[model samples]
Target: MKRILIINPFGIGDVLFTTPVIRALKENLPDSFICYWTNERVRYLLEHNPQIDKIFGLSRGDIKKICSKSRLRGFGALCGLLRNLRKEGFDIAIDFSLDHRYGLISRLIGIKKRIGFDYKNRGRFLTDKIRIDGYADRHVVEYNLDLLGLLNLTPPASRNLELIVSDEEKEKARELLFKAGIYERDLKIGIAPGAGASWGRDAVLKHWPPKNFAYLADKLIEEFNSKIVILGDAIEKSIAEEINGAMAHKAIDLTGATDLRELAAIISCLDILVANDGGPLHMAVALGIKTVSIFGPVDPVVYGPYPVSPKHIVLKKDLSCRPCYKKFKTPVCLRDKECIKSITISDVFDAVRRLL
Candidate 1:
């Protein structure tokens, strides 16, 4: 049996973009054992996917955390992870990480065939690669599927993002909603105001004003009698609070309340998710829930909802410098984020209305 390893040490959206590739691999090579290597934080997202036979999680932050506690333990941990990969005897590795470090590690682990993108000439160690400057022309899902061609594998016709939500997760979400006083009959709408952990400190650059979100939530409540829930991580509780503070009506604050899997569960229970371009927005799309996503510097064509269907509405301003986020880099905006800030509340509310 062939052992194939897929490496993508990135955020939730980047990893989810590879789901179609995983599905294609499983369909074409049913007997192959597929292992996914990702950041520990995002490992939960792939836990329920049956196509992935095994998952290995390791990140620099994990190593740093361990090293901070004990240097010897950290070194041993790295060695142990590398040793385990060697023992797995993986034949081919499909790497989505543009970093050369993953390619070097795959080589050291004795993987014979390495396939990936040669971004900035980082694929020097890759045996076969497609050279590109960045994800500019097409959706990331299409870019990921392109790597399959190197293996002589046919890409799946349907390239929809895949996320498997367990039955237990669904039940837990229901319980959380019930406790929040959101009944089954209530029209549930989720708003994720944060830009996700991937953007780090620059997350604020992607955020529409919290006051705008507050106004939009109140409008949604008034028009549809919707139960709005503020969704985000613990770090984003302040943003949620700000939205709550500025709002005319109260919203169920769930920021920092659920883990990544539970967040998916909660999003699954929502009729529609209105979010800035980030992980939660993609999660909703993966779960087949409608989404009205706000885009700032990022281009919706390259990173928007995968299928370009009516179920997903993208709200953005048409400006030359708007999609400043190109080739995985965003330049400092001098326009005070006019791209995102220009997207009026009415525009977003109308998009949400279309989806609802």
Candidate 2:
């Protein structure tokens, strides 16, 4: 195919997971023009990807403006987006996310070859459906690469994720940290205190408590003299405040200030990153920074630290109900979300100490 479109319109971590396929496609078909479709918010992450030639992003703010209070407006806005997408003239379309919306978009865009998984009843819209075998147990990167099987391409053995951050961005990160009182001799540890952007309270399922994070930061500061920096998007600014507020020695909050490249640059300078199962954790791992990953409702086997990386550490509470979040979109809790609640500060403290 001379032109290919890869669709993954969701969270930052899921989009990052698709990079392996992007890398493989470029390696196997260097001449092809690849366009990745993702949300407007995450456009920065993929903007610099060398494997892909173009990016098709749907701006959330424009959608909000078009469909603010009307159902018909929402439908019309979607129609406009689909109509615009159809004009792109893609030779093939691959949907990493198993959403029928993406599949239907591919179909309506008139791509001759469409590929996606059979989950969520999306096979009806796809010309090819790859059956997900024991998917819940497999790493998402593997599953993303499997879609390449449709093109008669074997999955590459090396699944090391890569994101290119410019040297200028690195300088920006150092300047930011320096202004926050981080000296060259100081040990830098990053804390991701929140999950990806969510609209409602159900987002609580994926987050560790702020107090626990505060306690862990305090311990790191007291024991190692580590300079704590809380990193996240604007949505997480409150979370940073909550964590820093609870701690005796406050962390430097960089939430809402950094974009994706700057975020990667910030992560590149860190000695270690401590976070829940989310985007920053994957980014840190990809950047080759040591990380202490905290697991609660999600299964670490599928989404934890890359097993091959020796520097990464995973801290999890082995509750029977854990991996409690299904499809990671919502929770399947029995009653209380003890999976997250049961993971104590002491548990995380011990893990951080080992990393330090």
Candidate 3:
């Protein structure tokens, strides 16, 4: 079978954004089998994609895994993977990863046609190197899709988020919600408090404060008759718990409790999700949930919420430093996150009122 390999090697949000390119490739080349390479943690995001023939997860999960013997094993695995692809005589190798590793590997494997961006440290290896033209000042999904222009492919001008929720996943979410005493009739709201990096804390401040979120939960319970749910990783559980503790009504804290798949499933059922501009926000959008994401420091124009369906919102502050982080890193700020802090609890509550 003719084959194509797409290397993303990035975050959950980036992987979600790349799904459109995968879809476009499949639509254009229906006969060529396509595969993806990404981190193990993000594998669930692409599960059940009709266009993907397979998904390979890399080994680097945490800091220790990178330092252990697993590193050597992973390198060997990567080589073996490349060799196996060579044996298949793959027709094309596309490095969607914004890094040199995949580009160099694509070159090493000697695919018939290697494709990548004309960017720093990796342009020489690709047979097709497309330059990124004035595309950074927009949502990442659009930026990723722009790469398809390299192949003369014009995808439908639509924002789409892809994910597969099986019966098993739905059942699991149902049981979890049932166990949490959340009934179908209760208005369900989801909140994500963690961001990708602490540098993006400006975005966090733009978010409704923990106490403010707590107050909103209280209002939702009293006025809207809503039940709240908080989502995050282990690191953000403490924050979720703190918010839950302060609330007048009880909320199910799923932070650190659900894996990526289960998290997606559970979020799919929510009436709405509130989050900072980050992975969970993207995930909620993919699931077709009404999500309100707060943005500060970083440019929302480049990473704003674009619900694949019709129900999502992004709240951004107007400031000169709105997008100071050019490369997704923390900026050396003169003011300590004033851009985000300027956004108040009232702003988020008003949005929730509108969305809910």
Candidate 4:
């Protein structure tokens, strides 16, 4: 194939997980030009990806507007995207979304070969369709890589993500830490205070109580004598600040203070990370930093830490509705969020101490 397109319309963690697929494709077909289409907010995660020739970002705001406005706008944007694809003359298009929408988009683009999962309403439009085994306990990375097998490509030996950090980004992160009064030699623990953007009260409830986090922070300080760094985007600044505000031991609130690359750089330097099951957890795993990730509604087995080893610890309670992965209109349980609340600050503190 002279040109290829890989579609991943999701958040930072999804983008990171899919990088191994991109790397496999590049390794198999070195001469082909590969491009990725992803959400605009997280396109930064793919910067300096050697496998990708170009990255296309779809604006969420524009998508929202298109859905709200005349249907013509959405179709117009699709047509524009199709025209762009035609101009590039891609020989193969892969709908990694594994959903009907991306499958339909691949068909509309009219690439010579389209490949994706054989989901409901998905086989009609593609040249290659692979039926998932419907096997239990399969990870998402494994599912995504199965697409390559349909193309007669062998699966790579391992699944891992590589995030590129520029020299400039490293310097900037160093400056940020320096300003925060952290020295290079000091032992540090990183904390991700907020989960990813979510839909309703479920989103707010996913977080551990601020008091719980503060309690852990104080214990880490008193026990380990470690400096704490709270990581988040601007949207989560308030949450990070809330945890910081409640803590008697001061934490370096780096929320909204750095971009993705800088955040990765800062996280990589840390001795350990304590976080919710979110993007920062993924970053910590990729950077080979020890992390203790707290999970409530989500199952750690499916989207858990990569390069699984002793360094990574996932804590969760076993509940009937524990794996309520998607955000629901109503609460998953009668107790609202017993899973998260049951995860005591002492549990987290003990995990961090052991990891350290």
| Poorest lDDT segment (10 consecutive residues) of candidate 3 | 197-206
Tens-place lDDT per residue, model 2, 292-324, is 887777777777766356688887777766676
Per-residue CA lDDT of candidate 1, range 78-193, in tens? 99999999999999999999989899999999999999999999999999999999988789999899999999999876788999999998998999899989989999999999
C-alpha lDDT of residue 260 in model 3: 88
TM-score of each: 0.98, 0.91, 0.90, 0.90
Please state every model's RMSD to the true fold in angstroms. Answer: 1.1, 2.6, 2.7, 2.7
- The worst-scoring run of ten residues by lDDT in candidate 4 lies at 324-333
Candidates 1 and 2 compared: the better one by lDDT is 1
Question: In terms of TM-score, which candidate is stronger, 1 or 3?
Answer: 1
Task: At residue 59, give the lDDT of candidate 2.
Answer: 46
Using lDDT as the measure, the top candidate is: 1
Predictions in order: lDDT = 0.93, 0.80, 0.75, 0.78
Name the candidate, 2 or 3, with the larger TM-score value: 2
Give the best candidate by TM-score: 1
Residue 130, candidate 2: how far off, in angstroms?
Answer: 1.4
lDDT of 1 at 58: 88
Better of 1 and 4 by lDDT: 1
lDDT of 3 at 195: 65
Could you tell me the TM-score of candidate 3? 0.90
| Model 2 deviation from the true structure expressed as Cα RMSD, one decimal place | 2.6
